[model samples]
Structure formats: structure tokens, C-alpha cells
Target: MKIGVVTFPGTLDDRDAARAVRLAGGEAVSLWHADTNLHKVDAVVLPGGFSYGDYLRCGAIAAQAPVMESIIKAAKGGLPVLGICNGFQVLVESHLLPGGLIRNEHQHFICRDQKLIVESNTTAWTNQFSLNEEITIPLKNGEGGYIATDETLKRLEGEGLITFRYKEVNPNGSMNDIAGLRNERGNVVGLMPHPEHAVEPGFGPDTKIAMRSGVDGLKFFTSVINSLVNA
Candidate 1:
């Protein structure tokens, strides 16, 4: 399967996302932010980055890109869309999902290994993990706080849209320690963690497998590929 990784100007992790797709036994397709065509890719990954230098707000400008329009349309039609970190910001900005990501309550950029719990295993991108399973991935961003109104929060929880929650200390003051969320259809997922960074050996988070053995993130990419192939 071909997984399209969108690259906006100033995007920092498009290459990483593409490499992750390749490692997962899927073809990686480069997608330009201004392009309207999806190149017939099976899925899309909006990698983390500082698009438009985060001038207005994280992902606010990039959300207007033509590529995002196509992604939003495709995602609504049940195409699998995974948003990582800043990409999550874009997802929220585009209203493809609910809520907004604000600056960290402490007002500083954060960079660290973050532990997250897989809550809803129904999403196409997260089906490889067991429910309540904990995995650590690189988490880095300035504006990473997730916020929604009380009613919206309740709706998300009530509907089982919350996909992953922070397992360790709350990193960015995200409501309910939400590190990730999925749409009602379970085809789209938006998360503030950088799963693409942990797909390879000697460059991933340490785990029980081995030092630098945290390939837990690889399952996310591979699971999506498996989902597509099976579908």
C-alpha cells in the first residue's frame, strides 16, 4: 500500500514519516501541501512540523493548504488519516476532529519520551495495540495542550473517541491527559506524540526488547498497512 506523507513548508518530520512507512512494508508517497491530488495513496500521514513557522497558530496556516482540503474530504469518506504532533494541530484547525491544541500551560516547548496508553483500539491506525497498553514515544512541541469545552469532552469520552492518554505525568496540560483521539468512524487519528520517530532500531525508545528497542511505534504504521490490505 502507498501511504502519502504530506510535507508543508517548514515541515521537519516528513522524511521520518515517509521512512516509517517504508519500514512498515508500505510505499511512501510524498505529497505537497499545495497539491490537491492525493496520488491515489491508500492512507495519509500529516507529520509533525512547524508549518508556516506557526505564525498565527500551530497548524492554523497550513490547515488552509489545498492538500488539507483533500485530506479532510478523503478522511470524511473513511480514508485513514493519522496526524502526529503539529499535524494534530492541523487536524483540529481543519475541524476534521474536535477541540484545539493550545500552548503548554507552563509556556515552554517540551521535548521528551512520553508514555501513552492505548485506550481505543478500534482506530485503523491503532488496532495493533491492546487496550490500556502503554508505550513510550518521542513527544516534542511548543503548543501541545489539548482543550475542549466540558460538553465536548464528555461527548468524546461518552463516545469512546479518546484513543490514547498520557500514562506518565501530563506533558502539556491536555484535558484528561489525552495524547491522542480518533474520529467516530475510527478512520482518523490525531495524536501529539511522535510515533514516526521510533520505527527503527538503535534510534527508538528503549524497551524490554532491547536498549534502543522501543519499536512500539512501528506497530502503528504497520497496523494501518495491515488494515488497508485486509480491507
Candidate 2:
């Protein structure tokens, strides 16, 4: 499978995302934000970054990019799309996902290894995870707090669209401690954590077994590959 990792002007983690794809035995295709073509990739990922310098609003400008126009259409047709960190902001801005992200409750940029519980394992990006399983992923963001209307929150919970939730503590004050969410079709997923940063055994978050041994994020890329192969 080929996964396209999009790079906006100020994107910081496109390479990391691409590396994760390659490590998962998939071809990593580089995608530019302005390019309308997706190069026939099987899946697309919007990596973390401060696109357009986060001007106007985080991801607001990038959401209007030509590439997003194509992605939005493709995603609606069931193409799998995963958005991480600032990419999550773009997904919400593009209306590909519900809710909004705002500045952290304490109004400061935060970076840490965040523990998340797998709330749903049915999405294309999360099928490898077990329900209620706990995993740690790197998280760094300024505007990472998630907010949603009451009705939308109810629907998300009732429909099992909530994919991941903060395990022990809410780092960003998101409503209901939602760490991630999936679309109704389960192909589109957006989360604030940087799973790409946790794919390698020696470079990821520290684990009880050994220093920097956690590689739980590798399952995300592998899960998508499996989903495509089995589809």
C-alpha cells in the first residue's frame, strides 16, 4: 500500500509520518499542500505543523488548499484519511470531522508523552488496537483543546465515533477528554497526538521494558495497510 503524507508550508512532521508509513511496509508518497493530485496513493495523512504560521486560525488557511479540495472529495468516497496534531485542526476546519480545537486551558504549548485509551477499534487507522487498550503517544500542541456542541457530542458518543480518550489526565481540557475521533464511515480519523513520533522502538516514548521502547504507534500505519489489503 502507498500512503501519501501531506506537507504544508510549515508542516513539521511530514517526514516522520512518511517514515512511519515506510516502516509499516508501505510506500511513502510525498504530497504537497498546493498540489491537487494525490498521486494515486491508497491513503492520505495530514501531519502535524504550524501551517500558514497558524494565521487567522490554526489550519484555517491550509484547509482551503487545493490538495485539501481533492482530499475532501476522496475522503467522502471512503478513502482513508488520518489527521494528526495541527492536521487534526485542518480536518475540523475542512468539515471532514466534527468539533473544534482551541487553545489549551492553561494557554501554553505542551509537549509530552500522553496516555490514551482505545475507545473504538473499528476505524481504518485503529483496527489493530484492542478496545479499551491503553497506548502512549507523543503529543505537542498549543491549540489542542477540543470542543463540540452538546448534540454533536451526544451523537459522537452514541454512534461510537469517539475513537480515543485521554487515559489518566486531560492535558488540553478537551470536552470529555476526547483524544481522537473517527467519522461515521470509520475511514476518517483525527487526533492531536503525534503517533508518527512513536513508531520506532528506540526513539519513541519510554516504556517499562526499556528506555524509549514504546512502539505502540506503529499499529496505526499497519492497521491502515491491513485495511487496504483486506478491502
Estimate every model's Cα lDDT from 0 to 1: 0.93, 0.95
Cα lDDT tens digits, model 2, 1-231, are 989999999999999999999999999999999899999999999999999999999999999999999999999999999999999999999999999999999999999999999999999999999999888999999999999999999999999999999988899999999999999999999999999999988789876666437788999999999999999
TM-scores of the models, in the order given: 0.98, 0.98
Which lDDT value does model 2 have at 222?
A: 97
Residue 164 lDDT, candidate 1, scale 0-100? 91
Model 1, 34-60: lDDT tens digits are: 999999999999999999899898999
List candidate 1 stretches off by more than 4 Å: none
